[model samples]
Target: MKSSMATPVTVSDITENPHKYQFKQINDMTGQSILNSFDAVFISNSVAFNGGLNVLKDSIYHETINKDMRYNINIIKTAKKNENNKELKKLVKLFHSKEIQEYVGKKFDHKKVEVKKQVSYLK
Candidate 1:
């Protein structure tokens, strides 16, 4: 009952029926970060594994939400001035390639994704 679902705001908002909150015991749900909140990424048991971490039956869960609180995000970015940079373009293409997407899915438990870039430099 101590996950994000039971945070002050959630509990206060649903005082009468707070028990209805899905994660109230041995929760793998996420909560606020120690130093970051806005746009912060919190991975739940369901996010990093198939069928949620509940069935992992591995000690990895000990390092997950219920035990530790650490989160990180990687944002790939290119400056506007690099619009026509061939090397950067190639790198981005490689990143969104099917092979890389599959690697990401296997390692991160995320779905395949593609990025399409449209150039309007003439505008």
Candidate 2:
């Protein structure tokens, strides 16, 4: 029973049935407001990049809802458009850059694509 409740907690239901902790439904979920009022928050991992982690000093721990589940970010270019658009090339280059790739990978969970090795690494 404990394990079942621990695994998947209906966050919405918590409001309906409160324990010792009092709840405050604030429209603004900024770190400052959260720290001043709320005990905890359920937010995206992306929040770590947007100064959220910095603000939530001690309240930094979080649990992933789905470890195996992953959302892929597909950058699909629009119809034909232009074959040699300098701006477009620059944009693509910026997105592909190591710094940008690293930032995105860390913040947005969009990993940089790696080339396959010629030699098989099978054990």
What local distance difference test score does each model get?
A: 0.44, 0.46
CA lDDT for candidate 2? 0.46
Candidate 1 residue-wise lDDT, 92-122, digit = tens: 8898788988897777555322334333221
* lDDT, residue 21, candidate 2: 61
lDDT of 1 at 61: 32
- The worst-scoring run of ten residues by lDDT in candidate 1 lies at 64-73
Which residue runs does candidate 1 get wrong by more than 4 Å? 1-75, 109-123
Candidate 2's residue-wise lDDT over 92-121, tens digit each? 778777887788567644422422222222
Candidate 1: TM-score? 0.36
On a 0 to 100 scale, what is the lDDT of residue 119 in model 2? 20
